[model samples]
Target: MALFSIQDICKSYPGVQAAQNVSFEIDEGEIVGFLGKNGAGKSTIIRILAGVEQPDSGTISMYEAPCTFTMAKQAADAGIAVVHQELNDVPLLTVAENMAMGLGYPKKAGILDRRALNARARAALAELHMDVDPNALVGELSVAERRMVMIARALLTDAKLIVLDEPTASLTEREIEELFAVIKRLKSQDVSFLYVSHRLKEITELCDRSLVMRDGHLVADVQMKEIDEDALVALIAGKRKESLTSKRAERTFGDEVLRVEGLDPFYRGSPFDLHVAAGEILGLAGLGGAGRTETIRQILGANPNLGVTCTLNGRNVQITSPKQAWDCGIGLVPEDRRNEGALLNFPITHNITLSSLKLRRSRNWLPFPSTGKEAREAEHQITTLNLKTPSAEESLANLSGGNQQKAILARSLSAGCKVLILDEPTHGVDVDAKTEIYSQIMRLAASGCAIILISSELPELIELADRFMVLSEGKLVASLNGEVSENELLKLCLTANSEMVA
Candidate 1:
């Protein structure tokens, strides 16, 4: 008998069929990888299995016995634990307190056992080869260090079936290796895992079996050895042949759109300077914390001035706020889209017209929105971008990740932006959506919109960028036009930080 089995699970929210007849099983000591694009029901199914939600119709069994439990106590009692993609550590609490919160620690006749709690927390950290002090506040740690704390928490549990949701999404390459090593150790101890991720390469290495989900249905279940990367993509996207648009000749190159000379934004980094031309596509390439985001924020008026001045269309201008930048025909699609770009609770129409409410304004007392105009614009953008939403009135949160991104792009375009800045435009997006986003960027450039592209993925920068610049230690170290070699860009970007140490 399998260790765990979920049969005929079905769940529906207001406008979303989160899961439909989703069935799967996992054997003890086996690692099963779940592959899906965003909104493919991966998280929903895992949540159900972890007892966070009760499915509308389903049967979850352990060892062929029907399992019924509440969300609170059942998860730990049933030996099911989850480590979310986002860290859940409390900033003000020490690592020991956070780790021992629900474990009923530091208690004897209502008295606290401080020494025992610290010792246990220290042991958990030590098991993972982490040397941080157990009494340190979580907020004092870095993103990677916080992730290690989460790992330690999960390991201390008696969890037999663990569901990891995008555990490596924000991890660096070396940290990912450490996590995989830990997983290997756990697998030897006969623990089962349901690993969810969009990274196909990691799936191949970490999973014994793989399951593919599409639109709330389990479409494919097979051994990891049976498929290649291309085949796996075809399975997920439901298409065999796909092509990215080739680079074309520039139709028009207007005057300088936004000029930044000697722009320096100080946030634990060196100073830098650059300019963006109208209808030009400028690419920023560097590893994390290389000041790419800092420079973009400075241009968008979100950074405190170290020493920066700007000119728009040959006229000197001052932009001290985001609204000022918007008035200057600049639109920013922020990296953290959920928090900064889109209003998650609002409908797609609201999100699409947020930056360009002028497009929907009609003749009426108090100047209310004209539904007719909003619908027309929404339909055009939806059809043009191939968004997969039932209607403009559907909540932005109801749409898939790719569709949400497309909606954000539509809003930026509708705002009449002469310059569009995108940070990690394809982050967390699938292959098909990546191609579509690149196409949209090209279309904007063709229509005389200067684009500033910032990305950590080198392949994406090379494939989509017209001209590339490398940032190292917050300094503009190199620039290349037409065709930039990957190796050359890497060498240039790493040289500045390398030189400082020498």
Candidate 2:
């Protein structure tokens, strides 16, 4: 008998059939991959299992016994724990305090025993090979360390099954390896995991078997040993995928469209200097803490104290704020789309036209938004970006992660930007959406937009970037053109020497 199993699960929201007739099973001591596109019912099933949402019709069985849990506490009592992609820890609290929530604090003589609580938290962290101080504030911990604390908290509840949703989304390569090590250690002690991620490489490395979903239906189930990454992507996408390759035709770039100099104090090293030509796609490659994001922030005026000098179209320009950057024709599709890019509560049309509302005004004297013009532009963007939404008036929160990202991209383009900076544009999106986004980016570059692409996925950068600039310790260390290998990029990112690569 399976340790946990669900059958014929169905769920729906107004104007959306979120999930229908979904079924899967996880055996004891098994790590099962829950693979799907952004809106393909994976989240619904996870929520149902965690007791955060009730399925319209379904039966869940644990240890061969039928079980029904209607609330999160009930699910926890039944030995189910879920660690979400967006962490649910109180930043102001210490690690021990966060872990002790809902479990009661240690007490001695009717007084809170802080030492005992810290001891317990320390032991729990040690069990997962996590070296963290229990008294440290949760906010002070790195993303990776905080994730480990979440898992440790789940273990405190004696959970037999745990679900990890995109657990490595914010982790660096070294941090990811450490997480895998912890997962392996826990699996040895018979902890079953339901791992959900858009990254095929993680699933391939960690999961024993994978269940693929499409259109709210279970499409395929395959063992890890029997499937490759391409086959898994094909299963989730519901079609065979061609290779991801750049379709850029050989063309000469025009004069430099954007230039930066003296953006010091960005990371801890030398001053920066860079230039991007019109119709050129320049790729920035680095590991976490390598200053790729800081570089972009400096360019966009997020780091005003950096004293950077910028030039746009051969004219010196001073960008002291994000609004200034926007007015100067520099549009940035930020790294964190949900938090920084899109307004989740707003409608898709609103988000699409938010950065360029001035252009949609009826007249200069009495400035009022032209609803007709806004609708027309939103519809055009929706079609062009292939955004999956019922209508432009639909709430952005209701759309899948991929659609939200596309809407954000639409916002950048709608602003009439001459220089586009896409920071992890395809971070949380699926394989099909990634292909579409790459195509759109190539099209943008072909149309004379200077593009700067920064991605942690080296393969993506290698494919799309015309030239690569590698950053280490906040300094430009190497510049390479032509075909580049992931190994070469990794070496450049890890090395401390500031050697130039021609």
Q: What is the clash tally of candidate 2?
A: 0
Model 1 error, position 254 (Å): 3.1
> Which candidate leads in lDDT?
2
TM-score of each: 0.84, 0.90
RMSD of candidate 2 to the true fold? Answer: 2.8
What is the C-alpha local distance difference test score of candidate 2? 0.83
Candidate 1: tens digits of C-alpha lDDT, residues 1-502:
8998999999887777878999999999899998876678887787788777789999999888889755735866788878765456698999998887656677667888888888988998887777878889988875557777887888888788888887765454445777888888999999999998777778999999999988889999989888887788877877773764556665467777878766554454545556677678889987655677778878866654555677877888777787788888888888657546888899888888888777677764536778788888888888776676767899987776557877886788677788888887766666666676778787888778888998766667887777887776677767778676777666766677544210
Every candidate's CA RMSD: 4.1, 2.8
Deviation (Å) of 193 in candidate 1: 3.0
Summarize candidate 2's per-residue lDDT along 160-257 as a digit string, tens digits. Answer: 89898777665667667767887787789888999988888899999999998887888988999999888888898788878765566786788899
Backbone clashes in model 1, listed as residue pairs: 106-113
Clashing pairs in 2: none
**Local accuracy by lDDT, each model:** 0.77, 0.83
For candidate 2, the 10 contiguous residues with the lowest summed lDDT are: 263-272
